[model samples]
Target: MPRILITGGCGFIGSSLASELLCLGYQVTVIDNLSRRGSELNLSRLLAMGAEFHKSDTCDPEALDKLNDSFSCLIECSAEPSVLSGAVGDGARSLLNVNLMGAVNSFEWARRRSVPVIFFSSSRVYPYDRLNACHYRETETRFEFVDGCSGVTQAGVSVSMPLDGVRSLYGASKLSAELILREYALQYGLPAIINRCGVVAGPWQMAREDQGVFTFWAARHYFRLPLQYIGFGGNGHQVRDLLHIQDLVDLVVRQVAALRDRPSDFRGDIYNAGGSIRSSLSLREATEICRRLTGHEVSTASRIEARPSDVIWYVTDNGPTGKVFGWEPKRSAEVVLQDIVAWIKDNASLLKEILV
Candidate 1:
């Protein structure tokens, strides 16, 4: 088995991937800053599972330089993932440093060693204004794309979608990183692959208002906390596709194997990894599901003011991903919700320390 290093490995997606890779007999090492809430707990879990961990910030190239570069692959998952990030105070600097500079340092390390890298990008790289301008109809529970909408279909938004408008600071940082990765791949001959992923949800996600909305909503319902349907007339019609961490790991494993075994076969450098229409969920629908799963109900208020750069609807079109990787999400929305609900229930005591 190949030894792998995962930056941000204590994060929801990164930690989940680490667990899966370890189970598959890969020698995994995780490096995380432990800055986020519940990250220490996640780190402990990874350590107990036999994953070597380095408590350091990826933004500091010096910190990353201290690590041994003996790993076969680097999974660069470190980032300030909130779209609402960088809107205030030092957030702007933090977002850029973590999402862009952190990636740069990682790429530099990989470049020096000629190591392969798997970069985890985001769907937010697509323009926010263009996505908002998409033709769509508001239904009772969610928004559906109207016929003749360019760059959109019943399946969802494709990579061909325009990248012309404001994509928020967070998105801009990730997009910038993706561009850098492309340059590195071409100029340095780095074996790099980028996956512009959608909403990734599953156990151990310390969801907050700005990021990890899926787990946040589930936790709110489980804890009987106040919930709200903000923006879009507060109808909770905004839609997004949810990708379970397990399914994401499956695709990642396959990608790593393909890159290792048949590098030439990895045609495209970028793929939109998500649930497509199969796991799409509206806020209203998600609330209902959480209610059922947790056996708890809390009144959800409505607010008319939408967040900056927030889109009304987004479902990833995984067509290109499936064609290139022969992979599709195996987990449904219900199953994803059930797993989150169960995790929250099991860790309610610990979660209250951080989530509440």
Candidate 2:
């Protein structure tokens, strides 16, 4: 059996990946720094499932060295969780250290041994500001992509879109890592794949005021915490296409399989792995769904200031990714929301850490 190592394996996406890979008969090793509450919980679940765990930060070479690198592949998932926090300048250093340098460490270590690697990238790397020219329509409660941006066949945002000046500090940091991954693949003959995912949501996300919108909303709705619509503009119609953890893992697995046979095809590149246009939803719609599902009202306060460089509607085109991995999102927003609500309602105590 081929061995695999996952950095930040205790994260929402990472944990889901670990579980899925274990079921597929691979020797899985999870490395997490345990920086977030959700991550620790994920690690606990993985440990219960008999997956090996190393409580170490990926940015630290000493911690990474502890792993038996005889492994065939590595997935870098560890990073500072909040893009907003990183945007605020206070969290810039942490973002650089964990998000950028952490990936550097993983790639460097993997390159030295000729191990193939996969990286988790965010859609924020796209020139979100340039998307302002795209059109959108507002509904009774939320917004939807207008024009050619709707339906499953709509071919969401492609990788070729210019990534010039449209990212927050968090996005910039991830973009830096993506470039480095590409460079390393070119220089060292190490096969590398960068998956640019959007709003990856499932169980085990650390819901907070600053990040993980879906999980945060679930927690607030479950515990009746204060939910606020802080000046995002429109009827709270900022739409985000969400990708389920399962679909994302499937894409990664496919990439791994393809690389195993033909490494060159998988190296030196980036792909947008997202939920496509049909899966996109707005804050207003999400709030209404939460209210209808839980029989609780979602909080909404008109914003005094609109969020910065925010796009009213943007959807990722997965054409290239589908061609590469033959993968697409399988879960509907309703199904994902149902699962999210069920998990948080069942694990109510997790909200305490979430609010903090």
Candidate 3:
């Protein structure tokens, strides 16, 4: 089996991928700064499971240079990841240093070592203004996107969605990284794959106000915490496609194999990935599911003032990726929610330390 290196591997997605790859008999090493909430716990899990760990921040290029080692592949999972991050003055530079510059170092390292790179971008790169402009019909339960919108596709928001407008600081950073990755692929012949993923939730997401919507929703309900619907007239009509981490890991395994055996055929281009239409859900719909799973209804407040960068509806069109990889997400919205419920119950004591 090929050895794998995952930067930011102690986070939810990276840790999950590392565990999966390790179980499949691959040697794995992870690097993390452990700066975020729940990272320490994630690190512990990875360490106990036999994944090697190194403490380093990607913001420092010198530190990254030290880890420019021989590995079959490098999965770039380090990013602020919050669409709401860097919206204010305090977070702007920090977000750029981590998301943009960190990515630069990752690309440079892969170029030097001739390692395959898998970059995790985000659907947040699509502008919120355009997403909101999509024509929609509102049922009593949720807001549904209609077909009048130019960029919108039947499967959901297509990869062809408008990019001429502002997509927030976080989006700009990720998109900037994607553009740079293209350069590395073309110039250095780096085996690169960019996955512009949507909301990925499952067992170990350190859900917060800025990211991890579904996991946070489930945790709030499980802990009897107060919840709020803050946008689109507070009807809880905002919808997004939800991808499970397991499905993403499944794809990564394939990408790694392609990069190792057939690097020339793997284009360093963008691939949009999410649960697609089959696994999308509205906030109201998610609330009902949580209620059923937790058997407890928590108080939820509704605010009409929408937050900056909040979109009404944004699901992914997996058509392009399906044509290439013949892969579609098998996890439904119900299974995604149910898994969170099970995780929360199983780790209620530890979660309360960080969540409550």
Better of 1 and 2 by TM-score: 1
Task: Note the residue pairs that clash in candidate 1.
Answer: none
Could you give candidate 3's per-residue lDDT for residues 206-239 as a string of tens digits? 8887689899999999998889998899989989
Query: Residue-wise lDDT of candidate 2 within 1-356, one digit each (tens)?
Result: 78888998988778888888888888789998788766777887888877899888877887787777689888888887566756654777877898888989998889888889899888878766666556656677666555542222235567777666577778888899999999999887789889888777777677677677877776678777666675546357677887776778888889878877888776668888888877888887888888877888856776746565466665677867886677778987777778788887788786566544
Error of 2 at 260 (Å): 2.0
What TM-score, to 2 decimals, does candidate 1 have?
0.97
Candidate 3 regions with alpha-carbon error over 4 angstroms: none
Q: List TM-score per model, in order.
A: 0.97, 0.93, 0.98
Candidate numbers sorted by TM-score from highest down? 3, 1, 2
lDDT of each: 0.88, 0.77, 0.88
- Pick the TM-score winner: 3
Task: Name the runs in model 2 displaced over 4 angstroms.
Answer: 144-155
Tell me model 2's lDDT, rounded to 2 decimals: 0.77
**Which window of 10 residues has the lowest lDDT sum in candidate 1?**
259-268
**lDDT tens string, model 1, 301-347?**
99999988888888999867886677889999889999999998898
Q: Where is the poorest 10-residue window by lDDT in model 3?
A: 318-327
